[model samples]
Target: MKSQCKSVVTIIVGAMFLFAGMGFCQEGSEGKGGSAEWTKVIDSKVSEKIGDKGLVNFEEGYIEAVGIGAPPEQFYGKPQARPMALRAAQVDAYRNLLETVQGVQIDSATTVKDFVVESDVINAKVSGLVKGAAVMNKTYLSDGTVEVTVRMPLSGLAKAVIPQAIADDKKTDMKEHKPVPFSKKPAPADEVYTGLVIDARGFQARPAISPKIFDENGAEVYGTLIVKREYAIQQGISGYARDLTSAQSNPRVTDNPITVKAISAEGVGKTDFKISNEDAKNIRAAKQNLTFLQKCRVMIVLD
Candidate 1:
């Protein structure tokens, strides 16, 4: 009787950590749209990192985790059991979300977990934030398990993790560089360049919380250095996509984005990009670029 009275929430949560420790493989969608056929795919289609613990949807700007639990044998048929099972699932969901956010890449070199581990203050704050994550959905499974989904906004999580004056970082001198045109076009350089889209595909670039862009001469072109902490925390340092069309079409960048090609992926983590001096100059030259870049209006197309 005592064995049957044990609550599944506590037991299931404990058992679930075993899986977290082992870690599951990253789950990604199959059949990406190549440039030739990008229009056919939905504009809303974007990259997602799914794992056994939870998922981070880059397009939708949220991290989600699903927690599962079941009522104990003794309480299975009682009215109080439903709430008990739901509570267990909710607890389990928060735990899963913690693991998911921890895995988020902060830069080419570190992850959110790495940052939090280095500071007990930040660790506590992030934990508290995750606890308050919204309960997006709750469902009673056909097989008896109760599942709950909790969602955490990326913007909110980033605000806490960004830390210090790093968000105020901008160390580039746009005036020093000579203008190198990306192409011969009717649009003048002074025209309204609403945003920037870096076609970084095939360079093996990966997304991060913040990433820097450099010219061939190793001068910084874009990133935290130019973007304000407020905007970076709002829409992230930059958005990412699997196709050029989707990336440019995104409202984040708006219309008429200055498109450029990346020369190579920089940094050991491949989170930063190096563009040709010519393309880099074009990105820096526009008078309107400053306003948009400040708001973090940029996108990267990845393979």
Candidate 2:
């Protein structure tokens, strides 16, 4: 009877090992399939990010951010996992957007953080700005990853942020200025023109929350608040250019152009003025004479 009992135990142990081996084989096959699926999903998602011709349209005056999310292991197999992942991705996208906007570059060797600390008020404003941003695209990958793209028009964003920043800093008093019609002024000389061009080559000249044009005496001739609200919204910039041809393409351009070289930039945060002593006298003369320059188109050529 003892010998028979040993034989039975041996058979049971052998069967157990056989079953374990079969389980491992099945698991290995499933893992291989899962890895293949993961690769396909990743490839497709990357292609989507690149878009046609592998280029993403980050047009001037528009800020865009992309985010990705995947469900955690604990949430996997749950009915709510897909939706939760998507929501998490959207939140991630907004956080990225905030970081992009808040990460302001101060100079070649420094950034905004070197000059000022971020406060709760600034965080809240950034949150509001993200909430108002427009949704650009959304995608789901077979590997359980969700992706989202969001964008905010700089024109609208500036209208909201600039005034608040100025109010908080109390650095400059923002007043409204009415533009006189170009028809009111007499024709300019051969050298004088209706439109304004600023040559900012050999230096960094970027878009800001509030950008202004100043004369040599430090008087403001053109600024964010000076332009009509509709015009600002439509143009989305005081002006920007890399060269004369590009400057001419600006919506603010005209047949004749008055050119100037930028001397310096000043003010706190993203709100500043680009000063030009070279054309300051001309700008003052134009303003004093109530020339068409008051309503003329302007462009800035940057390096």
Candidate 3:
């Protein structure tokens, strides 16, 4: 009887250990699985900050799009005829109209401006009279009051009539969410902040001026000139990242942003050239569209 009791106790203890081992294995698998990859992806040097900064963990997020009403053509007709002339005219008219009626109550103003008539062209008849596009201006005051000014084309009166009516109906729906006025003092905690919006679109990053920098051909350059500029991430975004972490964990966010400074082109003659504003704009646009995946990889090194 004594031997049998000891055998039973041994079996019970072995079973408990087996169960515990299985549980630990399951936990280990989970810890090494899917979510672990997210950490690694973020940890890679391309996106990571150097020198013990906090890691960035992304929460599941959603992008919500709020439509500020489509342009008139999309509302009325098919988008098959989006020629540049028409688009240009549309934008020009919209801007002009906004300026003309700056402070009028949108619902109460009932004036009209004339641009070109699309219907005449649509009907295959040439109406020699130049028809201008209608205009409407809306203003919102500091006290959450809204004002509107409208200029309807003679032929557009029909279309114009409905918008003001809709505006009238939706007046109550406008919530009082105006931004707080600018202050000499710091904003209260809950305000959204934006860093200085530099129009660096075409602005190439140049090396900061250094007193003792030299150029190619072994000539001592008096001031620091832009050498080579790799691409750089936005400062505001990286600054936010730096603020998120402290020194306690494996890493924390750093206060400084990573930048790619320009380098000098060795042995190249100083060629002074001027590009047109339009060309500069195009260059900026092109640069903005350049692939950022490579930048992400480079940032991983910093991480």
lDDT of 2: 0.48
Candidate 2 regions exceeding 4 Å error are: 1-59, 76-82, 102-129, 139-143, 162-192, 215-217, 224-237, 264-276, 287-296
CA lDDT of each prediction against the hidden true structure:
0.68, 0.48, 0.22
Q: Write the per-residue lDDT of candidate 2 for residues 191-225, one digit (tens) a residue.
A: 55657776755544444444566555555666543
Q: Candidate 3, which segments miss by more than 4 Å at Cα?
A: 1-26, 30-46, 50-53, 57-280, 283-303
Taking the tens digit of each residue's C-alpha lDDT, what string does model 1 give over 71-176?
A: 7878887897776676677677877777788787777777777766666666666776776666666666666667766677877777887643253232233444
Summed over model 1, clashes come to: 2
lDDT of 2 at 297: 66
Q: After superposition, how far is residue 140 of candidate 1 from its true place, in Å?
A: 1.6
RMSD (Å) of each candidate, 1 decimal: 9.8, 18.1, 32.5
Better of 1 and 3 by lDDT: 1
* Candidate 3 per-residue C-alpha lDDT over 107-219 given as tens digits, one digit per residue, 9 for 90 to 100: 21222111112122311111111112221232223332222221222222222322222333235322321111122343333422211111111222111101111222232
